[model samples]
Target: MASRSVLGDIRRDLEAYVGSKIRLRANKGRKKIVEREGVLEGTYPNIFTVRLSEADSVRRVSYSYADLLTETVELVVCTASGKETKFEAHSR
Candidate 1:
């Protein structure tokens, strides 16, 4: 229950970054790391989506907030003034 509360709070904070540019880094097992820059498209009760585009193709990836809580995903929001706000999983 506590973990859910923490995730809820984190989700609310992330909601403010919608439509903003953000850097997303995730682990794909076997020490592989994938990183991408995209706009925080939208946030739902259980998951959020990020829209990424390369060349002429665009894609949207959805990840659950629980993924953040488990350190599966890391997010960094880039601000207009060159400041970055990072969000990572925290030990509970």
Candidate 2:
């Protein structure tokens, strides 16, 4: 199947309301194991800005995988020695 641009869509959606408030999920840490809900501060083509609810700190997150799939997404966390660690996603 052809991969759709999911990340691109997110960017466009965010652009529609540049200064408005919105809810977003962000992954913290290099492993992306920690997820948190926060307010959407800004959005770029493949990047999103958020102020973390916990620490009230602003952070940038890349959403380049949005176009991968409609219901599922995958992230490659590591690849070494012919082994790989990936994150599988199911979106509503």
User: Candidate 2: where is the Cα deviation over 4 Å?
Assistant: 1-7, 17-32, 55-62, 65-92
Tens digit of per-residue lDDT, candidate 1, span 1-92: 34777878878988888999999998889999999999999999889999998879999999988888877899999999999989765645
The TM-score that candidate 2 achieves is: 0.39
Give Cα distance to truth, residue 82, candidate 1, Å: 1.5
Task: Return the TM-score for candidate 1, rounded to 2 decimals.
Answer: 0.88
Question: Model 2 RMSD to the real structure?
Answer: 12.3
Clashing pairs in 1: none
lDDT of candidate 2 over 1-92, digit per residue (tens): 32335455545655544444333433444755444444446766555555545675566444544532332223333222535333343333
Q: What do the candidate models score in CA lDDT, each in turn?
A: 0.88, 0.45
lDDT score for residue 91 of model 1:
44
Off by more than 4 A, model 1:
89-92
Candidate closest to the true structure, highest lDDT: 1
For candidate 1, give the lDDT of residue 47. Answer: 93
